[model samples]
Target: MPMPHILGADHVVVTVRDLDASAAAWAKLGFTVSPRGTHSPHLGTGNYTIMFQDDYLELLGVLTPTDQNKPTQDFLAAREGIERTAFTTDSAAGGAAELKKRGLEPLGPVHFGRPVDLPGGGTGEAKFNVFRWPLLENPGGMRIFACEHLSRHTVWIPELMVHANGAKAIARIEILTADPKAAAEHMSRLIDEPAIADGAVWKVPSGGRRADFVFLDAAAFAARYPDAVRAGATTSGAAALVLVTDDLAKAKAIPGAVTTGSAVSIPASAANGVVVSFVAR
Candidate 1:
């Protein structure tokens, strides 16, 4: 049997304590963020999304601490940062079965929807079927999942894709872990891309999604992203984002950008505790 298709990253979730504040911060960083959207009352969460062409970034926060929001709330309580990285899938059910065949039992093909405020002040719905496979279940770290976009029209708005900072695409996700080999192996299975050894670091090449994953050990991670480590992300999880920019000068001019060699790193302090690096194209 053929392996189920695993599309590249759909969106990354930055779990924050306050949705409005986080959205404002992202706007300051030059992203065109969407208006706040609330989940169904039962989920007790709200979010602001920065929509890109193929992928996006989500600022998710608990609205009311119910059973559904407890895990996310606890994550924020410990540390506020990139909480989960979600891959895109055409079929959540098939993905779950493929995962099971590969020796990882997925949690759900969980069905959920949120109300989206359309551009013209109309209301629409964005539905999803999610399958979560926990490689690391601890708080203040990254969780891996797959999201099947039921209504693509409702989520990907063309107007929201334009950013002032020349950010064209999400290039890579930097994950810091104690064991680079193990984390890279797990990410390989999760994203269905074989890991390539790059000396001490391991990288998953940007498949069709045009985004990759980089795995680094704690010491190397701290050396590269000391603020991310200081922000309570000492354990295994998604640490930072590498955004591809069209103009290096434009990206460098963004407030709080720290030029480190050729790349400009926006420390976690300004980015809801997630380090954002801008690489000139």
Candidate 2:
């Protein structure tokens, strides 16, 4: 049987308590964040986005105290950091079916659309179909979902592509877990790709040409970037994102950027509670 296509990282969701504050924090680090937008009334959430060439980063927060907002609220209550890693697919329904075949029951091709502010002073609809599984746990955790874009205009704004930090793409997503082997197996099943064991870490190819997912147990995670853990990131879940920038020196000049070897890390306090590492490629 042919393997299912997993199109790397579509975007990572950072659940924050305040979308405005979080957007400000990211902007301070040189990212061009989109204006805030709300989800459908049923979803009860609002977000600001940082658009990249192919993928993006979403800063999400609860908008209203409705049932739909419960998940965002809960995620924030638990830890306000990287909460999800969404993969892109050509078809979300097909992705859900393939996941079922692998013994993971995916929820839906949930259809939804949001109003986007157009550059020319009007609004447009950006639609999506998302498939998710409800049973996955996140102790050193991350949510895996597949997204199908119905309208490309909602994202990929040329104006939002320019960042002062020279960040162009995501290099890697690091998740810290209690058990690397189990996490690797779970990710392998999700993306239909074999996990490559790397000493104390497991590498899962995101099918994202420029990115990969790296899972490390607590000890290894701390040993590799102790400062991240020390900054109050949850010891067992989606940890830090490594972004590729063309000018390391310019990126290093961003406030709160600390250089560790060839990479510069922006601590959680300055990032609205997420750790972002910048690597000049």
Candidate 3:
């Protein structure tokens, strides 16, 4: 069963070195990138969001050096790509408390907001309350966090939902780990969900209309995404992001995208280290 306060997958944070350049790169891939939004001074970060129906992707970059952005800076020092994934929660505090009950220590119920330019000629604050799983306890070599959107309207703008690639929602997130079973079990403990074994892969469902987290060994990952260009030299961590699109033809038309049977994939080198694949829903 899922955690009481924890909903499902919310968004994935792709840490990039250059904010504007990364946004332009995703735009070239046919995604409708949102206007840049800067976080509060304490956070020292800015981002552009690729909005979908329920979940989204955040292109995050450091604007100034601060204690809060140390982890992000460290990750960027190595490579740019998905540094962490967030889960949806109605109450960050409640989620944290539940995590404590499960013998896992959560980081914080941090409060922050970004200024958003509303489509109807007004400005709004996209507020959020978030709490993270222990920083050092990176399951499947990726950080996990839970987010509570205080102002959903400011974040999920309808104008930003349309994409030229016809992408609708995140279908799945694939992680390559040395021990798929161990990785899946660790994630299961964090999310309070069961990890089901399927051949060489282990699947952890995020519940609702969200994506599943699939963990597999290197060989299985290679077999699954043969044409994908991995981001870093490391064999562990997030491997691919698959999206459900309305039109496969439009997705295949993206510059530099390769058609792998029924799916169209954008190389990780172009997408800040995460292989992006599009499949018709």
Candidate 4:
């Protein structure tokens, strides 16, 4: 069973050095990027979202130095890529309570909001309550958090859902690790989910239509994403994001995209250190 109050994948956060540059890069890949939204002053961050049917992607950048954004600043100093992934939660407070019951310490059920530009006119606040599974509790080299979106409609606007690449959803997240089994088990325990052994790879289903987290060793990751994998790349953390696209041709048409078998992949060098692959629906 899944963790209490935790729904499947909500969105993936890609920490970037330049918000505008990252947003433009994603737009070049055929995604319809949303207008940049600045978070509360205390958070000292901003983001541009790529909305999907159910899940989405956030390209985040540090706007100013703040104690709250230290982790993000540290990540940016090293490299820019997938910083964390958020799970949808019915209630942030309930999620934290469940985590405590599981013998895990949960961070704050903090409330924050960002002003969003409405489609037609005016502005709206995208409110959210969130709790983290500890800053250092990075399972599978990726940080995990639960988010309760109080103003969903302000964020997932219908107009922003359409993409030129025909991307519909995040199908899978690939994590490269020295030991896939251990990484998978760690993630499974954190989420109260089962880890399925798939030959040399391990899979943790996020439930429902949400993307599954696939953990594999370096060799396996290189074999699966030959064109996307960089030489001597970090052996762990989020390596790739696979999206289900309605039109494979459009994905293949992206500049610097490589087609291998059924999927078209963009190397990490071009995608802010995250390999992006598109497979037909």
lDDT of each: 0.80, 0.80, 0.89, 0.90
Clashing residue pairs in candidate 2 are: 8-206, 140-236, 140-237, 141-237
Candidate 1's displacement at residue 101, Å, is 2.7
For model 2, residues 195-246, the per-residue Cα lDDT tens digits are 8898989988878484788889878766766574248676668888999888
Q: Give the number of the best model, judged by lDDT.
A: 4
What TM-score number comes out for model 3? 0.96
Give TM per candidate: 0.90, 0.93, 0.96, 0.97
User: Candidate 4, residues 98-135: lDDT per residue as tens digits?
Assistant: 99998889988989999999999999999999999988
Off by over 4 Å in 4: 227-234
Clashes of 4: 0
**Number of backbone collisions per candidate:** 0, 4, 0, 0
The deviation in Å at residue 228 for candidate 2 is 7.1
Compare the candidates by TM-score and give the number of the best one. Answer: 4
Give lDDT: candidate 3, residue 106. 88
Clashing pairs in 1: none
lDDT of 1: 0.80
Q: Please give the RMSD of candidate 3 to the true structure.
A: 1.4
Candidate 3 residue pairs in clash (backbone atoms < 3 Å) = none
Residue 35 accuracy (lDDT) in model 2: 86
